[model samples]
Target: MICIRLFQWGIFVALSFVGCKSEPQNQDQKSIEKGIERIDVTEHYVSDSYHKRHDGFDWVAVSVKHHGDESLWVSVRSRADQKKPTCTYDTKAFRIDKNTYESTYDGKRIRFEFFPTSLTISTENPDDSNMLYFFCNGGATLAGHYGKIDGELDTQQIDLTTFSKVLNLQGIGFNVSSIEKDNKNTLTIFTFGLENRDYNETFTIEGQVVIDAEVEDLNSDGSPELFVYTQSVGSGSYGNIFAFSVNAKKSMSQVYFPPTSENPKINSGYRGHDAFTIVENTLSQRFPIYKEGDTNASPTGGTRQVSYTLVEGEAMRQLKVLDITEY
Candidate 1:
């Protein structure tokens, strides 16, 4: 009886160990199956194997990342014989669906269609071949299908620093790019597809970094307004806004944004880390209010939200605070 009891205890221990090990294996298998069905926008891919080995065949490589919720930053490179690249393109692709994207470069509309395992670049109108010839050389074109790669791409193969976004509304488009140059930030704003507006401006920003941008028609006018938000590069993260309104659908004029320092009531207990967004036709700014004994990292006080309405000021159209709330 003692021997039988000892044998039963040993079998129980063995079974318990097997159950624990099999549970993790089952979970890992489930995770792999889930990954197979997942459509991750941020992926790296390369051309087919034939192009990679042959000298005459041109090879293309691409990498993509999420620019915003509705757009992707795509970087592409094509080369032959391991020599200088024949084509290089880096820009934003606005999403049309879950797996489709579109962009306009040099006045031509390019489409990017993604499948489960491959990506294809083409134009909506096959007759418009100028864009393909213009972006590539040596008879190599940026239009092709590519296969997905599993791991990280080589760092030297793609542009990782530059920030770009393309915003379009009504028939007008704005291509905004930002780069760090000479210890300061530089922004270039270019307007396209406008009949009477040739709005291309560059600004040198000091002590701040461009965070995000939005486009809206505030007053229900036919034309739209562009707002660029910036934040200081430090612990404070003080925010600023640069805005431009389309004038009668022909030209654009700068819209003034009031500084917080001038408004004593709103400026009290303000220590930056602000967030701005457009709710309907009104612009809203929200930040944490700090009490007298609060620290920069931790603010014990509640949040302060300021709502502004667009109005014609003495000098130009500016944002006038309509109400302020604390909660």
Candidate 2:
């Protein structure tokens, strides 16, 4: 029965990481109030050429090192690469035992478990049969994935918020659902079909809510594009940017650099604090612009640097700003 429900969800995630190591240490005092003293784990494997044109998929970079610096990073995907169905790993395949760590290649499998507060990743791929789950709580990053299609198995989840902490990219299929009341935010954008069985669309942003979301490919032509970031209640540091394009079907009706009542630049509505990137394949942003009665706690109107370029079969795959600098 699917390996007994994946061994009862791996023993309820190892007893919820042993009841979160009995709580109290508060994640080592929030990593010593951010002057982090320790937190290590590094493993990377990216067999280039942009993951061999997407479906051969293979990239894994989980380097969450702290005291030794280089704070956060997380990304995963593997269907076996590095030359034909070959997979590899060392360092005892990421040791760590009791706190969990596992590995398997060829048929693909990966796991890294650690919990006092959070950090998790689990993967599987019986040759694209799929299964994945990722978690991180230094602020937020959660994910889930499952697959099957025609025979039925599908599952998906994604929740993001990282305060610009960084989480890079990968295949990232869509499947987000959301709804918020008073603040008015609605988002339901699904789309599955490796065998066909899912489709949805509903994306609203009436008054803002939705701290962040990411998925990129930004015109790499390998599919993957959905970037949402919102904010607005009292509008302290104005923010809002939405970009969608999941190969099309009028999904979210295509929005990139939207928000216009005439001249709303800087990812749609300039203000302050904004930084997004998707290098090489292009899609960059940097914000901070105010001056018409400035306020964002004192901003005079200076930073701005946009750059986009996606332009696919019209109707809505348009994002061609190409450059707009100002230091």
Candidate 3:
């Protein structure tokens, strides 16, 4: 199940919910809103060829746990090419996040010359709009960290088709929000896609690109690691897992297949989540976490269990799974 946190103005409802049950809720709410600052958000994405291959939906991504208030943040650009990702950050009309700081844009290009009307704004835009957008929302939710861009901004007509990018998924229509390089060559990716989102065999994540992916020397190895997420494109739910490699020299051989157990169903094919990293810098936790069923139970359900780990050189990887279900 996905999680949701509501926000009134700039303050989180939870902060008020439990904090002010018997107290004056509206007063606390007004005080928080009156803090008088600004609020901005940024959402990034990452995916692979398989995510964009079949389903049009490449991957899915969402902002860090926020109050989902009237304010909104729209992703503008995250092209597949790592060398040239143009996220609209500096524009006054756009809201952005920093990789290391809460106040600054994460050093990306944000073209918001097409300010106000450039975005359909709430009324929720398109279900597939991946670009990050900012909403001042009449400036009522602006927090301290929130600040305006550097220069003039306006609405300039550009091809809407070029605004598209592909992504990947986990648990089907799922997408990860954060993928921090762990202490090891492994990755810790947090899924912040949608709420109550589930993966049925019929859903897929496609046409999304992961941008600004990097790793830190959490272990002080001098070399930064690369972390990535997996999003399915065709015929199934997207954003299934996260994956990694020690380096170019130690890449593992992998495979994908339909279930063929003695009591397998007829047309049921299992979707795979990416390799998970249970620990760090140990080259450990390497395996597949999946749910499967035979063709006979295709639409109704499938069989799923703890599969085997990826047999690495001289070592065996372990699998860590929280839950498994099929549709």
Candidate 4:
């Protein structure tokens, strides 16, 4: 049964890479509620620590399964060769306590075991496990012993105080699930199990991208019309994205992103993750209106009506598209 669950998530990852998987996640499970799914979990986990790697500042991230309320998982990364110089590194780990015991990852001896490859803890105890899962540099950058990059915690008092007071998500485990580049300068924030739930975290978001929106041409001219976007976050317009038109007074009118079929179908009606801006990255799926002939377009981008000539000298009216990448 557990293997089935992992397989399900694994398949989810696969589908995400190749567009998406439409199957809704199991909503009855308690752990599933942590973030609704792995994407939300990883988004919340990475938060500000996530680097889009635009100019080469990338984070080596990894994750482990929950061992029945296990707490504290750590990540270790180094550029030096581990086998030659005896493999010592500046390792980072998450902290542990009673209330957050089930919410965090414990990184004890995370450095010693998975160097040059990967490591898995071998201990039977959930809290004080003595095993480290290790792997070598491969597709997922497998590292040998002491070479794993488990999610680390901010042990500093300031991070602790601010995280506790602001996010109210202290001790909750973090990891990078699926990262996608948005627009031309931002990254979409998706966490493990963030759907259907609202997280109030101490986040720094610049240039708001509205979700659950609509677009209409009020001038009777065929264009990407007035943009009406929204800022909700749950069922019944809670986590809604809004995109609409500018009214007569130059204010935003009520319109939104078309509900095309290409998006990952959520249990709720119409909602999506925040849009991110990134350079040379894929635009996330959001704020679109569903209509015939536009069903197969890439889910996200600044696509709008354009008149262009094809090679055959045929005039075609279509929406322009952008690039797509896993990030």
lDDT of 3 at 14: 8
Candidate 4: segments with Cα more than 4 A from true spot: 1-61, 65-141, 146-152, 155-185, 188-327
Among residues 3 or more apart in sequence or in different chains, the pairs in candidate 1 whose N, CA or C atoms overlap within 3 Å are none
Each candidate: what lDDT?
A: 0.64, 0.41, 0.24, 0.23
Looking at model 2, how many pairs of residues clash? 0
Candidate 4 lDDT, 24-67, residue by residue in tens: 22344323333322211111122112233233222232333322
Better of 1 and 3 by TM-score: 1
* Candidate 3 runs further than 4 Å off: 1-225, 238-327
Per residue, candidate 3 scores C-alpha lDDT tens digits across 1-327 of 110111112211100000000112245544544354443323222222112423432211112223224323333322222222222121112233221122123333322111110111111223312223331111111111111222221112111111122222221111223211221122123222333432221112244322222222222333222233333333442333333322222222112221222213322343432222223332121222243442322433333433323223433222223234332
Residue 77, candidate 4: Cα error in Å is 7.2
Better of 2 and 3 by lDDT: 2
Tens digit of per-residue lDDT, candidate 1, span 1-327 = 000000000000000000000011244543443345337656766666323334455455666777656677666544323555555555557778767787676466788666665666778778764565554556656566566677754333332323455677878887676767557788889888777966999988888876657788886788888888788888888889988888777888889988875778699889987868888887888888898989999997898889888888787888888999999
lDDT of 1 at 105: 60
Give model 2's TM-score versus the native structure.
0.26
Worst 10 residues of 3 by lDDT: 13-22
lDDT order, best first, reads 1, 2, 3, 4
Highest lDDT model number: 1
